[model samples]
Target: MKESIISVEGLSHKYSSSWAIQDIGFEINKTGILGLLGSNGAGKSTTMNIMCGVLNQTKGSVFINGIDLRKQPELAKKEIGFLPQQAPLYKELTVDEYLLHCGYLRQLDKRMIGKAVDEAKERCGLTHFSKRLIGNLSGGYQQRVGIAQAIIHKPLLVVLDEPTNGLDPNQIIEVRSLIKEIAEERAVIFSSHILSEVQLLCKEIRMIDQGKLVFSDTMDAFNNYVAAQSIRVEMDRPPAGEELLKIEGVTKVEFLTARSLKIYFDGDHEVTDRIIKTSVHHDWHLREIFFDKNSLDEIFAQLSNYTKSVN
Candidate 1:
């Protein structure tokens, strides 16, 4: 079995009187990219802060690589690279200087600091802008610099909250690719409300709503979990609803647009094969026979709606 790099058990957080996050639990294995998805004020940032040791947990515990965050914060943090939603950059400092400073902050040897800074800059494609002050760089470049600072210490896990929050299409693509490259060795847990971004970057997803976990699974598993596969059959004029419902495993049938009937089936072998065999027997001129699967956004919306209804 793969070792879990980050573990949260019965974790909860409160601000004064109200709970920001309540009893959220999940784990990220090493070398995995887990997308932490939620709506605005859904406690994504609050959870990340607790994991990174920036804020104390109100209840329960978090362990990174078996090191308790609250017990040995410094040691636990050494295994983490955190990039918050806001890019924390010293505007006056050049990219190279800021990265070097980050290395020193991590207690790297003086002799190794320069080499580490260069490596981080190279990985983030900031080698050319090393001497440029962060304030002068474009927003995308500044974000790269921020990412460079985060990985200067070569931590075991990287936590980025909304890394691609506000960027142009090109910039977003660059950052997404950069994230993919960085996750080659270590685990990455990035929080985002953008469903498309999560779909593009993460192999596994953990969705939270109203401070509670709604779902956790791999991308394929998630799609399968919430998918409603409809077998759309095209014919000039087919019998109406009840005729199709007579078939085995056919749950519901609806007329979609013109000259098409979308039949909802169990998506099992027996049902799909039966549908095909039925079509052949009927000699219906089937223009199309395919499953219309749902996208990640659609799945998320369904889960969100269920959460609201339950609450």
Candidate 2:
């Protein structure tokens, strides 16, 4: 079996009297991205901070590449790169100078520092801005510099907390593409509060709510866990409630407007096909029909219940 790149066991942290995270544990192998998901102030940052050795956990252990993070921080951190929500940058320095500084901070050999900085710059598309002051770079390029520094040491794992938080749509796309490339050869912990962002980038997701890990599984498993409860249907010539109730598998029908309705199902297969056929037969003029994705809050509630039930 392949060894895990990072292992977190029974991790817990307290800020004064309140616990920020409790008994949080998970492991990631040395490839692919794991999305750490939560709402704002849901302990996502606390967890990332502890895992990246920025803060000491009040309890439990974090092992990066089989080395204890708290015990052998210097050695273990050699295999981990971290970019927190706020980019750590010296805006006054040129991109090249800043990257060279990061290389030294990461403790790279003097002989390898130049090559490492160059490679990191190339990988992050910062070669053109090598001489430009980081302070003068756009928000997107600044984010790139942040990411470049994270990878400057070529760590086995990279922890990024909301890398796309402040970027525009175009910049978000660019950073996402860069993340994809970075994860190809190493493990990455991508922390974000945005549910859609996690859905788009990660194959697996870990959801934290109210200082607890409520769900930890693959994205496919998460989708399966939360069964779609309703579907939205728009019709031109809509049918009455009495007429629609005659269909199979539909438990409830809520009309939002004269032409739009919400249909609730009881886990029945082919409900859409049946609805489509009925619409054609009755000339209800079905314009569009699609299942409504469960909201993040709804999913959190469901997972909370499951966690309670299993425990």
Q: Which candidate is the best by lDDT?
A: 2
* Residue lDDT tens for model 2, 1-311: 65579999999999999999999999997599999988899899999999999999999999998999999999999999999999999999999999999999999999999999999999999999999999999999999999999999999999999999989999999999999999998999999988888989999999987778888999888877788888899999998877877889888899999999999888775898999999999899999999988876678678767666765
Deviation (Å) of 181 in candidate 2: 0.6
Per-residue lDDT tens digits for candidate 1, residues 231-310, read: 77787657667877888989999898677888888756467677767767787655677777777778888898998999
Least lDDT summed over 10 consecutive residues: which range in candidate 1? Answer: 267-276
Off by more than 4 A, model 1? 1-3, 236-284
Q: Provide the TM-score for each candidate, comma-separated.
A: 0.86, 0.87
Determine which window of 10 residues in candidate 2 has minimal summed lDDT: 302-311
* Candidate 2 off by > 4 Å: 232-237, 242-261, 265-297, 304-311
What is residue 244's positional error in candidate 1, in angstroms?
A: 8.3
Predicted structure 1: lDDT = 0.86
TM value for model 2: 0.87
